[model samples]
Target: MPVQRRIFGRPIPAMSPRRMAVLLGTIAIFAVLTLVFTLPSSIPAGPSLGKFTDHKISLPKLKHIPSPSILNPFRQAAHAPPVQKNSTNGESSWYSNWNWLSPFSSSVTLDENRSLLPPLPDRPPIYTYYDHTIEKEQELKDAENAVLLTWRKAWWAQGFKPIILSPAEAMNNPLYTELQMKQLEAPMMTEMSKWLAWENMGTGMLCHYLTLPMGSNEDPLLTFLRHGEYPMLTRFDNLGSGLFAGSKADITAAVKKALANPELKAAKDFISAVPPETFEIDPKHDALAYYNDETVADKYPKIAGDIVGNGAKGLLVLNQLMISHLHGTWQNIFNRGIAVVKPHPDHMSYAVHPARRLAEFLAQCPESPMPSSCPPNRPKCKPCVASTPLKISTPPAYRNTSDLYTIGTVPHPYTMAVLTAFRDDISIPWIRRESPRDPWVTALTKELLGTGVSGAPRVIKFKEAVASQYGTAHSLWITAEGDMPDDLDWHFGFAIPRNATDNGRSETPVPGPERRPPVEHDFKDGPVPTEAELEKEKALLKRAKEFGEARTADEEKIRGAIEAWNLADTEAWKFARAFLARSSVERKKWEEEEKKYAGGAGAERGKSEGWGRWFDD
Candidate 1:
């Protein structure tokens, strides 16, 4: 009989189920390389496995060996493994697009390539972390698989690899909230302690995450951790050896430098370690306490010193102004009263929140929540009360008496300098004849805060305008909360113009803590105005000064009484008139295009020429 044809092409197939299954299994085994288990070191002496080309492997020359037992899979215990940097191709290459934007630019060197940042180094892995976004899913998945595969590959060994780190924010992450992080950190620290007991990694070595200490540029802790790596490991560990870069290095160096100064870290290591100081999170008590205790040290007394000392002087002028604005000064009695306002940038929760919250309270309110303060009559107010919004009053009123005009290009020296330069064209010289009945100026007495769209430029137009009845250099005051980079230019393009009078008019120009934008008198530059052009500034000062001081003192007393009564009344307006002498003008001008465009973008991203013009009225 002819062999029965099965289906396709007349082939008679009569086989046992086992044989058929074996044939299909062999095909699958050769076709895909997705098996988690190890491939034998060698294959049978024949052609080669499916898709095995010369570029991939020379299987014919390879030795054959039995793979790991399937039943015994996952039975091996492995050390924590390092990550590897491997290129993906083959099928993946089909989906890959050739996109290359080197963040390091072409000028990168081997040192730059090697100098890496420590990625979110919380002690415990962020698997248990909240705030996971879709952007992180791929990275998290890839990292997990890579970690697992590395351990699987080595049977029971560990591994690690190098990678560049980006800014924590753009890096697509929210650090673990302190409470939740402590949950994981406690366990990690405990496990580490036990691991040390079992493996005896010495006390010289540490396993904490890369966290800097509070209120300090020097991180003795980090320096100690990095330096200890050499002594602990018999084999090399890149993770332990070079875990910090940039500012971290600066901090470590500063720690060593400060230690060498015969004060901190001088007598003993253990003793020099940060001590537990009892302190409140309240800004007033904290500022006072911190300043006092901090002053005990001569060299590195306290970070608070920056606030109370230089900051304190500014605070004095500001306090007087607030006092005058609240009660004593009659400037705003008919509804045009002035007050001081501050714009604060928020801070990280775990590490810096308490400091910020405290600082804000101290700044806007008196040192005591009670109305009784320095000047007897100044009214006290709640930190967040709505008494009035005055000019931004964290001060040496913004002035640019600097020589910022040599032809050159360098990063501006901080936000202060930038705003100082921008000051020339940005402020309102004086308001035109608005009524005392105008709601904002008269009734509400509110000052406008700089409100630029997030990621957009700061641009706005003033309605009716007036020339400064005060002076030509229209500088003002401000207060910023976050970091003010050293490169920020507090006195850039807007050099305070020379007076038409004698140069002895050496007044302190506009000043604010590094990055905060200062208040502006908001006017223009012509040949410097002459003394003949001056308004009655002397009479204005004499009349305004004593009244300002007395009113400030009285307002201080009233503030104390108000605080004692648990009222929200504030002294913002009383002092505002005494300090601020700006007259915003109505004008058609395009000034500070960069500021208009600078929504916190870095160097290249900042605005172009700062001058543009609108139609003149």
Candidate 2:
């Protein structure tokens, strides 16, 4: 017989009767109730019973995003790299696996500040593009300035000034005893010396800064920075910082000379319009762009692909590359783009991808001319709304994609309901503590998992979010929102060390390396819940229950029959949204019944006042 092969320590195609049981139990729970009075599908129609409260609310409009260009298919010349080469098997491959200490790939959503879009559901997507050359140019210019400012903030955020002065402080502080000062000065001065040395060398500076990736000589982050054509610095300000502050007089003199040229006036107008905040690198996902007359400038990819579409894979790949290059390590989808200077547990962490300059020209705009990034002229400011409608589609919840980050198809209602409960009710330790169970989550979980909803995955690896090959959380199926996360099973960050036969050290990824021996954090010892536990959680069904409080035997028989039928018709009723809509037949029937009640002098109030309570129970 063939040897039992293990992939990622877990068997492929997965294992168990465990899954079968989970599946069955989930199904039995989520199906809708049987019809108490003739299939109960009819709904109230016509004039609605809309609740009207003067409660002030702010249903913010969806954020507007420039519609990507779908007109031009991603044009690749015959000589371009083959597009089919993109693979979803992340870290498993040699390329991504080699860089262990590096940050996660793009496609993982990480948002630091507010999101680009107002979020899904309440707000529709924003995908309109304006043809305004000057406007986009101005937006880029503003973004570049913002980048510089954010870097300046970093200096303060990191408390660089104190850290920078530490060496000098050790030697100069008189309060220190002479011997103590000497010792203090030695180590502090040594660290400072090392920092300066690494700074000069650039790549080696990473080693002096942080532990693991940054400090490790083996790390690839420094490789990324040095690999660029211009040798991009750890901080962009390093570029302008080199220009002496004392040289401002000379710079001003040169500026006046260039200003004399008539051509410079238009350039000045564009530069004057760039808002500084646009360039503020969030270390998460934020693309600030402005399209100049000649070219478009934005940190984000300019390619337009369809939802789970055309060039999305490529764009996501590029995003991953950039993240790996910038932050040393990051956790995405946990809450968009969360960057971890060190190791972290959750996959979905908040992160931000600061706007990258699309081009040099757009980076110089000044902010005075209504630099809202909106166009001044009518032709360019076309909104996707009334003009060309926006089309939005989520990843498939049911059908699996060839790639890792995308979910297969829309999940079943019970799946949605289960996830909804998990998202809202169960608070993972980091984000929340002692969050109560949400009613929606309670209902959904009971219907799907505890109840045995169909199409539901019996076993879910609740937390696992690293697979450099695919995108991160936000970029994947489960967004910061409580939707389904795309590839729970596929992300393979944990590299288990197997028998010597598995692979040699050479095969191990350079960044993460092979994990230490083996430790499953085994939960296998957990005993099943005792009978007492089951009794506490179990609900009671009262034999005295009846529909519409009818205590008569006829009413009891009809109600019992309805309940029994519902158990058998689980699938059809689970997705029966039609029942939620209003029906004219039901309305007329109710109206007739009301007229009869009025003619019969209110028919002496029913004997059962709170009769339907048990059913709710």
Candidate 3:
């Protein structure tokens, strides 16, 4: 059997238990040693043990770095370090052998020092400031009221009855209220102050506010004062046919109704003649007739001396008329002898000047006679004259003369000239330069104080003085209406026929401030304007004057043309004249159209016509 097994070659025999055990143990030991040698150690490379661990090598110091001992795993000084007393200096510190940890915590670190805020006072500073402002406003109000009171007393004493409107009633019309009127007065007040100061120094002038009433007799202010009523509100008619609320009839009716009130009657009883001392001369006796009787020189006085007195010797006739109207009771106030009702443009009696009509005709005349220029019998022979018959009438009992002519609706160009001169020479300059704290104002204030006048009276003395010098102090109409205290409605259009609309009627003009709108100013709190700003303002005013002058010049041209055209008797001229003779609305439209057509023909014609060129260069 052994010999046969030998043939299988190398067949393994079963080992003994002891030998197998020993071999298994030895193999286990060898596997364990190999695994132990191949596995990596858990320790990481320390910061100092890396490439930077070379002798004398240094690492850059990083900014804003945190403590290293606290972050280092090798160091365990994160908590409290061992405390040790300094043997040499008797000082105590937490770090003894450990050099990294700080003795104190981060909470106690004092790196940067800064100032601390002081404790606030019991009362805030803002409250004090507010109180001061309120007090100041009250003081100003008191001062203003005092001056107004003094003025009222002085005027009342001088036999000037207050044309006071009910504040509550005036409240209905925004323009008439006290507060609103004050806004309008603000600029005037500044001028008034300057004027007053100048007056205190003996520079006599007149204020615009003092010279005019709150409104003209035709304005609603009269109705409001006389009747405590407003007229029926009508729609704004482009045709201009609608009756104005403040008509004579309305005023008369209001006056009649108002007479029933005993309070008004009692107030009327107080009316008396002004004192002699109130004026330099007997104003009523020396009054010059402005409309017809006298020229400006005849009505006004020449200077008493070579130096020329600062003021006129006597009151103007128109001013006297205005005053008389104010002084008279409602019963006799609107008497025809004194106050004639300004006629409405829609009335048949409303007439244009014949000269104006003639000028218009001549302006339309062709250089060479057209078919219409000459009649059939006299073809191309002579220029035709457009005939306009004058309406002749006998003078009424009120008139001294019987041959009175109807005045044209055209306002004289002199008014425009005067307005321009005033604006450029006086108003604009005053507005830009006037200030309440001006030297003049200070001087006046001192003078007032010297006279034992203080508070509002002292302040108001300035207003009074200004009124005498620059304002219409002669105008005694006192309105509670604040917005339009000047008694002017500046928004009204020109009353000329050329400005008429296309509705075959003229616009109802309001008798407000006759001059151009004034520049806005704040003499109270506004900063003084620079030279550049003043110059700009002056330029604007100049432009305004230019515009006004241009309009006036255009009106003059139109009037001249109308006169010339009226003289031409040609059929075309007659027909054109007939069209113009129609309502002002129609005529204005025709004139505008004529100018437009004429402007296209030649530059000379274009340059000659002025009516339709308000915006044109």
Task: Give candidate 2's TM-score.
Answer: 0.19
Residue 426 alpha-carbon offset, candidate 3, angstroms: 51
Candidates 1 and 3 compared by lDDT, better number: 3
Q: How many residue pairs clash per model?
A: 71, 82, 48
Assess each prediction's global lDDT (C-alpha) against the native. 0.22, 0.23, 0.25
Off by over 4 Å in 2: 1-391, 398-469, 473-617
Tell me how far the alpha carbon of residue 99 in candidate 2 is from the true structure, in angstroms, after superposition: 19
Which candidate ranks first by TM-score, i.e. highest? 2
TM-score of model 3 vs. true structure: 0.14
Error of 1 at 391 (Å): 21
Residue 310 CA displacement from its true place in model 1, Å: 32
Ranking by TM-score: 2, 1, 3
Each prediction's Cα RMSD? 32.5, 34.4, 39.7
lDDT of each residue in 1-617, candidate 2, tens digit only: 75677778986664579998998877766453334443545756655535544456888754552223323467332331222222112111111122222222111112111111101111111111111122334344333322222222222111111011112322343322332322333333343232222222222112211011111111243223223222222222212111111122332232233333344323322122233331222231111111221111222224222111323343233323222222211111121211111001111111000100000101122121122222211123322111211111221111122212222111222222223233322112411333222222223224235534432221111111212222222222221112121111112111111112111222232222233332112111122334443233221101111122345775545434432322212211211111111111222233345333212221112223221211111
Candidate 3, overall lDDT? 0.25
Which digits, one per residue and each the tens of the lDDT, describe model 3 over residues 184-224?
23333332222222222221112111222222233343223
